[model samples]
Target: MHDHRRLGRELHLFDTDPLMGAGLPYWLPDGAVVRHVLEEYVREVERAAGYRHVYSPVLGKRELYEISGHWDHYSDDMFPPMRLGGGEGEEVVLRPSLCPHHALIYRSRSHSYRELPFRIAELGGMYRSELSGVLGGLTRVRSIQLNDAHIFCTPEQAVAEARAALGLIRRAYDDLGIRAARYRLSLPGGGSEKYVPDPELWRRATALLEEVLDGIAYESVEGEAAFYGPKIDIQITDPAGRESTLSTVQIDFHQPERFDLHYIGPDGGKHRPVMVHRSIIGSVERAVAHLIEAHGGAFPVWLAPVQLVVLPVGDAQEERAHDLVRRAEARGIRAELSGPGHGTLGARVRAARLVPYQAVIGEREADAGCAAVRLRDGRRPGAVPVGELLERVGARAGDRGAELWAAA
Candidate 1:
């Protein structure tokens, strides 16, 4: 088993407690840094794709689900409603998905075919009434922050839009050095209560997915689709020979009709629009957990919670260490200073706790105006210069952990 508790505490990442209940994770300073960096990268990428970011309230009115079919289909995964104050019975519910909210946005506005594909994205929190027994670490939690996006598109734009979603997933994975990710078309279950009653829509949507998956490296997985629609689920394998679903791009054929949503067409007549649902990077918690394990806590410099840890060789050189920290911080590097312990050995030991980058600040280097950087990146190391260390750090940061410095 992975020593998540030890690593989380020692690295100052995150933790869980019996008192707080299970299925929930509490992120400490280090873990939250990972979240912030990951969110920055995700938003940057999504924005480049012309996706408009938006937010919806975490708690929605109980009746909101009745309009979205979530009450009938997804009630099993939802938290029970809360009766607020007095006179209110089952009045509030934690939203299980953003589709309902996005649908409302679509209904709130009038649009023409010219503005065909309206991509709305959010890095929002979703809650599930999961069994406390099943909760582990970040991988399985009651609360999840996901990269969710809903696209309002015409039938003709469906194919290109699907490709765009695929590109986003691929690019994100590639940036993270997840070279083995593959897509699976999650299809409707045959004769199952999980499926919506419309067989014709399922057929059309599945066909469109197959066409979209054409020439793309993907496989078809049966009975894996969400009840509402078929989806292309992205998969990634860990070092332990276990695989899990990471991201998804789903197609909805019936939600538009259910929500009574439509757009003006080239013929100037009302026509139904299709919904393209997508989540790249899946849940922020799960993704961070996998990264920690995959890289064994020795994160790439770009993703490192502490990109550079400067050690003051002695009390006399403490001022220089502080200056170094400021320089790194100014350059957007997550630099930290250490004067609590003396000597390079203490610094090395303390830096070892984080699994990367150490610098020694002694009188020799302080006089030389350059700190000796020890390249202890989970492997053999000795010393380099401060400026040289920053160059390597900057390069790794640019890579976004795509080609991280792994021990050969």
Candidate 2:
């Protein structure tokens, strides 16, 4: 099995320390670079899809979750409330989820029917209190940076919005090279306390999700649904063949009622809006963990921590290598210079094998103002002009291409 924990440490991607606690691993510089690129890509996609981004506090008052039923139904996985000053001070807790805060955002102002399908997105942090034994690597963590969003739309618009969300999830999976093991229609199980007790609401919400998943192959799984609603879970299998959800699309009717969310209808009366919750990539940490294992640390060109490494064969070529680094950086490539001090040309190339592109500036190539190029896949494109090299790399990274070179 290609375990991410092993690969992450080998690649200097992330680590956990005893002082910092388990399941709270911190990202190394290389890992941060990959994560930043992934996050920016998600933000750009959401912005283009009409989602208005927002920032919300990670701490919410106890009453906030109580109103959303997290305090009642899901408090075991939530951190205990912290009293601000003394015992009498107001109680606040690290939020277990972002939906409550987003519900508050939706009720901040009255809206008209035209603005019914208002979408809000955030790459924000939330905390979960997990049992010590179950916590492992990035997959299960105490803190999570979620790629979460909520779509507030009319009942009539709910299906279309949910279907669009599924489409978006598929697009993201394709770009990220993630293969879905299966789609699961998660429904409430027999435990009444595990889910909201409104049978009619559950029925309606489940039907809406079923419609959104129309013609899609999925297994209906009881007890896997969110406490407030049913959802479409996109499941991915790890190298060990263990399956877990990586993305989800859900229809929520409960939160709108809890928050009293309404918009002016065409009949000049207030009508309730449905909340469609979707996450394209569930958590930044888990997503990167999956990517690390999926690619075995040789990430796609666009997401690679160091896209290009410029190597100088000897002291004579150091100046040229430095110049090439500067030019590549100017072109938005994550370029670094590995000088002769690192080792022999072959040794340095081997050291940076995980890097997508390696441009070797030797005596002959330096004089010719070109580079002897080698790809991570062991393809030697031979000597290519410096300008052309930078352009090819920049274009490939920008396009998020899986192949290092255009032709291949």
Top TM-score hit: 2
**Candidate 2, 309: how far from true, in Å?**
0.4
Per-residue lDDT tens digits for candidate 1, residues 118-197, read 99999999899888677777778899898899999999999889888988888877676565557788887665787787
Worst 10 residues of 1 by lDDT: 375-384
Among all windows of 10 consecutive residues in model 2, the one with the lowest summed lDDT is 399-408
Residue 135, candidate 2: alpha-carbon lDDT: 95
Stretches off by above 4 angstroms in model 2 are none
Q: All models: lDDT?
A: 0.80, 0.94
TM-score for each of the candidates? 0.92, 0.99
